[model samples]
Target: MTKTLFTGVLSLLIASCSQQDDRICEAVAKAPNTISECVHREGYLLADAEGSIRDVATAVVEKCRNHIIQQLLSKPENGPSLEVYATAIEDNAVEEAIRRVTEARSGNCKKPE
Candidate 1:
């Protein structure tokens, strides 16, 4: 019984630690600021077909969409599936994430001075 309890506790600890190690997962698990930073570090800006500059964090977000969905779904509040979340952010989603980071950066990031 003691061995089983110890193993369960150890498993939980390991899982928590592993989640912290994943930047994208951590961001999704944390506040908006962290999410913005994570997006910024993994994304950039690009000119859209409409000749407007946009953040390209959508690709990064998409790349980690599955992980993000899983993490979010782990919480009782976010009960959406991966496909639902993907559809919501499919259009310029990375750009939106990048925009958040850029907004928070306030000219501190790659934005031209």
Candidate 2:
């Protein structure tokens, strides 16, 4: 993406940080599996809009989801199922944070599929 487009996107995301955090957090807290919670959170994350921006965001989302799942899976004793809800909250927080950071960084909007 051009620097201007990247800047515009990042600016858009930075401007909207606080608004989406709560919803994302809630979704993350209740998710079951990494992919499941990710899928759920992703829906919440992309609650609006269409087109390549959404497509690019989806791509990054997989990475984000895996990152969360890995974190949750690391503690097998707790088991992903047992602690999924609480982890979802954290996952949401982390995801939102990632969105903000990515927006600011605004890497190439790689298509998810």
Candidate 3:
């Protein structure tokens, strides 16, 4: 009984540590200033596409989409079949990224002088 309890506790500890290591979204979400700066840099590279803020935003999100999906999949509590939620997750992630970039550009994602 003691051995079984120790194994369970150890498993939980390992799982929690792994989840923390894989939490890319959590890290990004926590660093608003960093996200703003990254978006600004990416947007500057695409500055030639004037009047297409959405396109620039989409490109930035696409750059990070794979990492986002990988982070989502790493969560032990997520569904077993990522394929089932892939479309919805992609759409939601893109929409949210665009919204955030747009908001930041208006407020904080300024070109550094």
Candidate 4:
């Protein structure tokens, strides 16, 4: 019974995370500039606290970069040619996210623990 309860709780947690990701991604799709804030707020740190700012930034990008791109491409406004723009959009998002993280880190803001 304990195992079953744990599994159920885990499943709910996973679902909630996915839902949160979806909501953030959708917002990103509407406002590309918010990518950095969203990433910083919601992204999981792939680096230890000792890692450099750039390293932590890169890790943040690696976390949700794809999901943002996917959300952008999924928009109906883009239609069929959205795939053609995917590369450019992704490139911009990555750069923006990295830049944001770097700036935040430089401001003495602590990376998530």
Evaluation by lDDT, superior candidate among 2 and 4 = 4
Clashing pairs in 4: none
TM-score of each: 0.32, 0.28, 0.44, 0.44
TM-score of candidate 2 against the unseen true structure? 0.28
Give one digit per residue, the lDDT tens place, for model 3 in 62-85: 765555556566645556566656
Ten contiguous residues minimizing lDDT sum, candidate 4? 22-31
Candidate 3 residue pairs in clash (backbone atoms < 3 Å) = none
Better of 1 and 2 by TM-score: 1
RMSD versus native structure for model 4:
14.9
**Candidate 4 per-residue lDDT over residues 2-107, each given as its tens digit:** 9999999999977764342322222222223455555654333332345766566666766666667666756677365766566666676566656555544334
Q: How would you encode candidate 1's per-residue C-alpha lDDT over 1-113 as one tens digit per residue?
A: 99999999999987764332222222222222333343444443321212223424445575546545554555445656766655554444565665644443333233211
* Cα error of candidate 2 at position 71, Å: 0.8
Question: lDDT score of model 4?
Answer: 0.54
Decoy 4 TM-score against native: 0.44
lDDT, candidates in the order shown: 0.45, 0.50, 0.52, 0.54
Point out where model 4 deviates above 4 Å: 1-36, 42-55, 69-73, 77-82, 111-113
Q: State in Å the error of residue 21, model 2.
A: 23
Write candidate 2's Cα lDDT for 1-113 as tens digits. 69999999999987775343432234243543554445444544454434454453555465456655566556657455746755674656455544633442243222222
- lDDT, residue 10, candidate 4: 97
Candidate 1 structure lDDT:
0.45
Clash number for each model: 2, 4, 0, 0
Candidate with best TM-score = 4
Q: Is candidate 1 or candidate 3 better by lDDT?
A: 3
The TM-score obtained by model 3 is 0.44
